[model samples]
Target: MKNLIILSIAGFLLGGCTTGTSITKEGTTNDPKWHKVETILNKDQGTFPNLQSLSEVRQGMTKDQLYSLIGRPHYDDGWRPREWNYLFHFTTPGQGENDITTCQFKVIFDHNMIASSFYWNPINPKNGVCPPNIQHKQIANKRYTLSVDALFTFDKYDIENLNTKGKEDLDSLVRELGKFKELNTIQIVGYTDRLGTQDYNEKLSYNRAQTIKQYLTLKGIPSQIINTIAKGSEDAVKECQGISEKKQLIDCLAPNRRVIVDVDGYIEGTPENNPAIK
Candidate 1:
């Protein structure tokens, strides 16, 4: 009778082990049958990856490269696992502003630790595939130029130093950004006139760019999608070589002392049909 009890106990242990979650034969870790929603770190708040970056994801990319593009998986799959899962949110075309489509993306890695296969689930029959609105759409790349004199006082690069006109300009920019439901990237490039030392100019330009980024973030732009670059005294649009007067030189280099913001995002429909372009 004791031997019979031991056999029953062994069967129970084996059954418990089988109930634990694991990757399926198809290499999917987030099977709805066994996967729990609470296991996902992001949960309801999925990532909104740039459309261009999503398009760039191709087969055979390394794990690091994939991480840089879309970010780490939403859930922990295990150590050195072959599958990575992500939850992404996209804005639906012709829908209300609050309406968004959530999709599950899966990436399968080969033995060599390289991404090989990609899959998207919860496909919409009307939309055709998982990632909707990406195909047949064009990214509207717009550039806005803001003069340094209008934005800040001489030799100032802080939000507190932003002039009244600067605030209005940035506010207008925020409104322009609101037109698009999906934003890819916002690049802020800072430039300075050739007056100070090279190191000082570089530092000043960087600080200016950083200030702009901070202002935009405060106005509701995501910090992750904004990038800042400093180009001090480089690519000057106007060169005043013969002007020796300090005021004249500075005035001549006015065009160089400016910040350029490049915004990239997708609009509904093709380039020809996009109303924003027209």
Candidate 2:
């Protein structure tokens, strides 16, 4: 009788485990039971995605569209699968800087290869709710172009060469940066007019970019997130072909001799509510 009771208990436990997997029907990608976090092969690789981009994901979006927006899924799931899964990290509300809430996002596609449903787990009580601090926020890319002529003396590319106007312009830029929430990257690309030798132009442009990066770092921007590129005499905005006069050529190529700063990040509030937009 004791052996029979023990066998009955074991069977009951096995039955419970089997029932758990059968809670949701097979091929139902919208259900959390369809995918398990432990089954993810490349887990936790998805970091903070652009909040606006996450919000833009909608039903009927193709796999390419989804890839273009928030990037590919973290799992090694085959491309032709009916569902794709991703793990995302979101900033925890009222928590320390290092604190984050990791969530799983699943996209289910219909028979025609169109996304039909999306699910997040552990699920929120409200339908279609995302992780914390992931409201449908607006994200904007800010670009600033500063003429090298205005930033430095002729052919000089050092912090000390920054003129009064240059300092003022950069200070204003720092203020504008404060409006952003999570800054992804700040790219500073330097260019010069096509007068100097290739080597000379490359060095000059690189030094100019380095100087701008240094200035931004001194103003409290993190150095690691800033990248500097030197595109000497490449992609020239102005071409001074056939100009015989030196002054006319210089003036015409002034637009090409510039540093372009591109800032990518998300901002709080709508366009109407944000003063930066105004």
Candidate 3:
């Protein structure tokens, strides 16, 4: 179904045809067709409703199975592997249909069989929040996903927990970033262990993130260039054991007590203004 859609659009564009009706996986519809077609397609996931799970969307399937499972591709971009994209609206403008949203998926084929696949519901994703605007980067003559992580601590934590040695190390990092002129955006991720209740943990995480931003500002890093986030105890350490009955939960979740800072932007060459941080 997806491949069909892509083919439909490409043919329409190349031929400069303005057919009163546009053909889509959900069948055919007239101008102002997107909403109606999307509604019909999502009626029950038009292409491959039964093969719902990622596990079920296997890497290899006989042509018969592919047809029965996912209808004919509406669009196939043929990117290295093949790409089939389907568009559907889970929501309509009427009442707040939060449950009714839109989504997309891509299936890549190697030798006409699935090689890799991805499903996305961009309303919200797990990899933290994303900025409003982003432009992808091209690295090594090929496209790549760029990501970074930043670590921040308050003066008190640096003094008591991290000790002077850690503070000195952080100072070096600050200098390195201060001298950095290649990046455009910086993301500061903050974390707080479960030492306290959830509410306190959230506040603590926010404060820690702010502390880093403040430090960066003092170093003349500029506030507008940085974005901050707090993860709290969500990503707790997985390698550690449970804290003793007498111990605190925060201690047990200490592994999650860290932040990730990412800086993105153009380096020396290339097209410029490419988003770096993922």
Using lDDT as the measure, which candidate wins?
1
Worst 10 residues of 2 by lDDT: 17-26
Comparing 2 and 3 by lDDT, which wins? 2
Q: What lDDT is reached at residue 32 by model 1?
A: 33
Per-residue alpha-carbon lDDT of model 3 for 23-111, expressed as tens digits? 33332223321122343333454331221221234445543465565565443333332344454222111212332233344443444
TM-score of 3: 0.39
Error of 2 at 64 (Å): 1.7
Order the candidate numbers by lDDT, best to worst: 1, 2, 3
Cα displacement (Å) at residue 240, model 3 = 4.5
lDDT of 2 by residue, 135-186 (tens): 4345678899998998888889999989998898888888888788766568
Ranking by TM-score: 2, 1, 3
TM-score of each: 0.57, 0.67, 0.39
lDDT of 1 at 154: 86
Candidates in order have lDDT scores of 0.74, 0.71, 0.43
Evaluated against the true structure, the overall lDDT of model 3 is 0.43
- RMSD (Cα, Å) for all candidates, in order, is 8.7, 9.4, 14.9
